[model samples]
Target: MLADALGQVPYFSAREVEALVAAWNKPITLRRGEYLVQHGQVERNLYFVKSGLLRIYYPTETEEICVGFAYAPNVVCSFPSFVHGTPSEYCIQALRQSELLGISKNDFAALLELLPNIARFWREELEKVLVGRIDREIDLLLAEPERRLERLLRRSPHIFQLVPKKYIASYLRMTPETLSRLR
Candidate 1:
């Protein structure tokens, strides 16, 4: 899966792809409810999801606000923390049993030196994340729950296959009952 994802990068050559596969050498496993990242923790590794699901959220006194998710064949990381060496406010937790491969900051930095093309992949991924965050902001800004629900349905129908309805409701900034009624 890591090779396949690396292969998709337009700037990567076959050798660069193999180098990435080698760099992502740390194996990780999580049972349900395990935390990949927690508030105040600095995230230093980029993870490739080999299997199962993860929830990206922010914890608060009242609730955990569902913000995003990562699943099999996708990459997962606390972006700001990973990039800036700062502590993350968000938490990434396993929602089900999961397997992953991770590339540490040191390894990735070395790769950035060895393979300039890999930087392109990182930039593109960052761009996508920024765009998605902007779109999610717009979705949350909508006053009507129905509009938010419909927009998500149109934009990410496949998400229903990966995440539970409760998290979907939270992502839409609505109660599960409200989401149920809207559906």
Candidate 2:
């Protein structure tokens, strides 16, 4: 699973990949609806999803705002909090029974120092995620609800099948009725 996930990134050497696999061999499991990282807690680890799905969200005055979803073969963490060692403002929860490989922040930092190629790969991956977040922000600001839903479907058509409609509606910044109408 890790090999497949890293196949697209060409920077890692065989040795570096081996080291990464060893370091990330710590396995974790989460049942559906279990919180992996809760708001107000310091996020100490970065998780790689081997299987299943995760939802990232934060509580608002009236409701929880769904910020994103992480599917298998993807990385899921409260990134800002993990990087800065601050309490997370968001929460990460398992949307389905999940299998994950985790590396603590300190261990990840040490691994980066030990393997420059892996560090480069990590940087590029984070950059891509940052760019995607910026693009999504632009979409949310400029697109109509229907347009937003259309774009999401185009990008991740399977999300409707994998995630609940209410969460999808929250992620799209729309009401459940609006999402139903769109469907």
Number of the predicted model whose lDDT against the real structure is largest: 1
How does each model score on TM-score? 0.94, 0.93
1-183, model 1: which lDDT tens digit per residue?
Answer: 889877877778999999999889899999999999989999999999999999999899999999989998889999889989999999999999999999999999898888878877777878998898898889989999999998898988999888999999998999999988988
lDDT (0-100) at residue 147 of candidate 1? 96
What TM-score does structure 2 among the candidates reach? 0.93
Residue range 86-155, candidate 2, lDDT tens digits: 9999989998999999988888899889888889988888898988888788769956899888878887
TM-score of 1: 0.94
- Clash statistics: count for each candidate: 0, 0
| Model 2: lowest-lDDT 10 consecutive positions | 3-12
Best candidate, TM-score-wise?
1
Off by over 4 Å in 1: none
